[model samples]
Target: MNSAFSYNFPALRGVQGGKEYFVVMVPLRLIPKIFLFDEEEIPPEHRSQRILNKSRVPDITNYMLENSKEYVFSSLTASIDGQIEFQSFSDNPNFKDLGNLIVSLDSKFLINDGQHRRAAIEEALKISPELGEETISVVFYHDYGLSNSQQIFADLNRHAVNTTSSIGILYDHRDQLAMLTKEIIAETPLLERYTDKERVSLSKNSPKLFALNHIFNTNQKLLGKKKGEFISEQEKTFLKDFWFSLIGSMTEWKQVLDKELNPRELRANFIVGHGVFLEAIGVVGNYLFYNYPSDWNKYIEKLSTIDWNRSNRKDWMGRAYGQTGRINKTNQTITLTANLIKRKLTLPLTEQEEEMENLLKQGV
Candidate 1:
């Protein structure tokens, strides 16, 4: 028998101020691919709260092992008003990043959890000095004190109380969404350090558009079916096909963008449109790939013949929904809008183009 006994999953939902709440449990596996330290170089704090160094780091792993089954795979709501700070503890080594994670002597700086990850951060810094300056999650307890923080930590530590609610579902979906964003950012050297707040803001402010991008760009295996739904291995292969096609298509659009658009204004588009364009590419990429087109530019010329916008907005939206949008229904309006965007990429734009009419409204 395993050393630990069976325990229920933790309740992700709870109440505060007489109001019921939930915190979504986003499995690490579901987290969108992000750049992480090499496993050997990961800090102790960065290790899963469930495993590290034969349990030398701390006992957070024990809780996960014994009670992960009981933890509700849902969202929880707690008024989160703390900051994530990463401090380095080094003795003036030539490499600033090789230092340990330093928390000030202030009891307020006590770790709520994730000590191993912190250690890994130090190790990463040694190899890549730029990493020494990254922010990590933590809950400050200066005002609340150790007891309150510990209670918060204990609740987080508890793995066998899975009582999740509807709101919990939303939170969980939101987290999955965030993980996807992080994965994309990880690949872009220019955008790696973008804050979670910025990423969330971009998605929420334009949920439908972003969702369309996610569907078109992500691997099918990585796709989230809904809050708490487990991803299957088959879907992952599909997602890979989708990601490659989408990236290839973006190469053409980026050239178009460079000629007439301010890159920043198009940030959301690049974020969202990359996926939509990829879907369009997938629609025709197999043909192009097999034919061995000598020039990508010629392929773009060929793509220009396909007019997605020939259908009315409502009908186009219906198709997008029927296809990629079906998995996790975001907003149909945004989904439809994204399809039109694909048309703009593949077809010629009239001098008085459709995009001009909506661009201002969308803050694009």
Candidate 2:
């Protein structure tokens, strides 16, 4: 490391909500030097106020590498704990004006937020060195002490909320599964009117029976599509046909589609209206399409015989519902539900499915 560490950043100084801070565009190459990640494992004697999540670093690094040219990140929040001097070319440094902020080599910079992004950038640069030329915005505040730094971290994260999956699908044009889900909802008669478009879960009294996010995820699982993978036209058509045939065999779904019943009533009375059952249907359909494609429709009749109402405790309680009668959506429950559907259709289980059945029998 160079002993004489100095950076002259063109910055704007402003007061936000009664606090003064500087915003500067920083090159990626200088990020690691200027900001240090306060990991959880660091000893208390050398620890800063910030807590770094090392587990998240590798995923963020992989995302950075995968979407290098198309990625966008929000501004990083940092605190400077040393001599900070601001030199203004203008006559009044107090007003909003262009200035040069300089920091001494002895200064300590601590990140209050965006430590994962900083670590990811460092790791990404090792594989793609040209990324060093890219720049990210950094917001700097003068550090008072550990207390103030901790408070800053708390205040910054207090109101953060993650984006919902359904909204992500609705607005995303990059994911092929999302596009296919939208098309299926538009074309499939049973799903057309009862699919919630903007949320991941439905309210009990909501007119919609299922969430668009669930349908997208189900299709992804059925088609064996990973995140960021493309879907072919044939696969999309197959998904449409599979969902149409499967829902056609579901009598309750048909009643709702034919205006003989209300979706809210169906949602209240049956488990089939929920996303978990739709996912189970997708799993069963995927299995049949792969193993019994020539006569997959012949097994569709089995879905009608299986009572899908939540009140059918003998059939659904231990498989789809917990002992308390609430729906269980764990992977174990999903596999068990698919196993029940498979047994009803007289379909043979794969090695993994048999293992799942054995685990269920052991009360797992």
Candidate 3:
């Protein structure tokens, strides 16, 4: 069958875990009949062709006019070509004139993968609903499963930059944190001495560490297993905000550490004490904001006194290694510690800090 008229298969299909190549192929007549778009799936770009900022390529309209006549889709079985072939109707208005094209199929392809190609084709069909163009090159295998396909997906997606994934959201939120810090520093340029990385690091200290350490040390919770993976994304967001808020409250505390506390020595102390503190930060932080606000900073400062170079006693039956969990607990604990340090250094706490401390103590 011709490639152009072959797309009319059932929209959904399933594959098993075995290894086999099903001779699934497209028929010519079904291609033109396939509807590319519905109401909501609008095309994203005006032109299908990408603009080449550093190259001499003309704009989309001129590029299409000059090259459309020579364009050809490659066969699925042919040697792999690096060129990008599929383009939307809006990208090159002349894409419609190209007749049916052949494509090979792969066993484990998903709609999420073909979104762009599908979008372009759909837009073209919308503009000229009656116009007939059929067949697309597809190849398929049966029983060929996900592990093999994951590599293809990863390779195709290596440079794709997933802006929608949970990690992406975290990264973007970090940027927002940086921006907010910049705004704060504009008002008080004293913080300009700290790099973005430094500011982010300082913002993460909170007192939940003390509570979590007590729980873990008492064998009340286990953070090492593959448990709690479901809320991982939400936990991350919570952590980001918790850290940012703590860091934002640290202006006076930072000054005290700079003057009397020795940040380098204090940080070394934090890194060492984290093993016992990890559980507290993740488990207790959420509740303690209103539960133990009064002495949270004081507890952070106390915990920071634990010497990292000397302490190696295991916390969970020697079940875990490294200090990540402990270091991770520092956000809330350290925030509390910084506040205490400020008190000792004659820096009065802000009204927000005082109110927060009260709410935390009351578990409000």
Candidate 4:
């Protein structure tokens, strides 16, 4: 293969399983022409390629365009079936690991993962050709025929796991709701002491009162904030005051705070102890926050009057606990549970809540 017709990159050489791999930074413009995700999955081997989920590509493309100034993406993984060579910059031992990696233009490239990102870059380039100068990294592996490449794909994905929602909320800096949720936890000693900052579901004896994601989501409900909306300092203060006042009203939570009751048993047996009711209470607060303004704390105190036992069949059967005798965590259950709270507090129900009640009464 002629050097003039080869793809060239300043690549960092690495080794794994006693084989060579190279990490190269590629200009966005060359990615589509070189990888060609829309074309077919290759190695031209007898193997099934994971179909590109076309719907997902548009969202990723939009994300790139919207956050062009500050967007971040992980390196893409690819396998190259071509003649390859590395040209060292100098005889200096330090320069040995840094060099131009050259691959023949006739080589076939196979994406073992990140097909959506590749497709998205292609779509984005059509609209924002100026972004062509920007670069993305690719980790390239030498294409070994059918069996070896298949094994590489399997090993690459076998141990992969999606980050849990709570951890996502914990680490996200851009979303206002996530930041607000973190502030709420940091400001409240009770939450800081008992919140599960990583996982969503808590084991019965895990000693956590709420998951970080639950606090994030319910606060979104409380403020009626849409995605990407900014939270004002005044609103942040209101939420801070609201949580403290609301926590003050819950006797069992206070019991846990004072160590009078076991948090494990409380979480195990009570509706007030769960995030479902926090959301219901948040919905109730949305009305009170907007309607009562100065007197919402008094209305929040009314929570003390409700029985929070999971065994309260008449109140929780279809609200927090479903017909299956298990706690329900769906959005419908959150609203239905809010309806029950509204009734207990003698607060008027929204037309939508009334409609939901009517539908339930008619068994719809």
Which of the numbered candidates is closest to the native, going by highest lDDT? 4
Cα-based TM-score, every candidate: 0.28, 0.89, 0.29, 0.87
How well is each residue in 125-202 modelled by candidate 1, as lDDT tens digits?
A: 444454333333222222243345446556776885543332232243333443444454455332333222222123
Clashing pairs in 2: none
In angstroms, the error of model 4 at 287 is 3.0
Q: Residue by residue across 1-364, what tens digits does model 3's lDDT show?
A: 3435333232112233542222223432333233122223334242112222322222322322333444223212111111112222333544432222223332123321333333333444455443224444543332123344444445445696533322232233223332332333344332333323211123234311112112222122222222112324433344444444444444433543356544444444443223333343333344333345454444344433332332333322111223353344333443443344345434466675576557646755
Candidate 3 global TM-score: 0.29
The runs of at least 3 residues in candidate 2 whose Cα sits more than 4 Å from the true structure, single-residue gaps closed, are 1-5, 43-55, 92-95, 230-233, 358-364
Question: In candidate 1, which residue ranges exceed 4 Å CA deviation?
Answer: 1-181, 188-197, 201-224, 251-253, 256-261, 265-330, 334-364
The lDDT values for all models are 0.36, 0.82, 0.34, 0.85
Q: Is candidate 1 or candidate 4 better by TM-score?
A: 4
Worst 10-residue lDDT window for candidate 1 reads: 1-10
Candidate 4: tens digits of C-alpha lDDT, residues 1-364: 5789998889999999999999999999988888844245544456525668898998899889988999888998988988999887788997788999999989988777788899999999999999999999999999877577667778888999999999888888877778888988998999899899998877778888888878877798889997568888878888999999888889999999899987788987898777788888888888888998888888888888889988888998877877887786788889999999999989999999999999888877
Clashing pairs in 4: none
Clash counts per candidate, in order, are 51, 0, 43, 0
Name model 4 segments beyond 4 Å from true.
38-49, 54-70, 87-98, 120-130, 145-150
Best by TM-score: 2
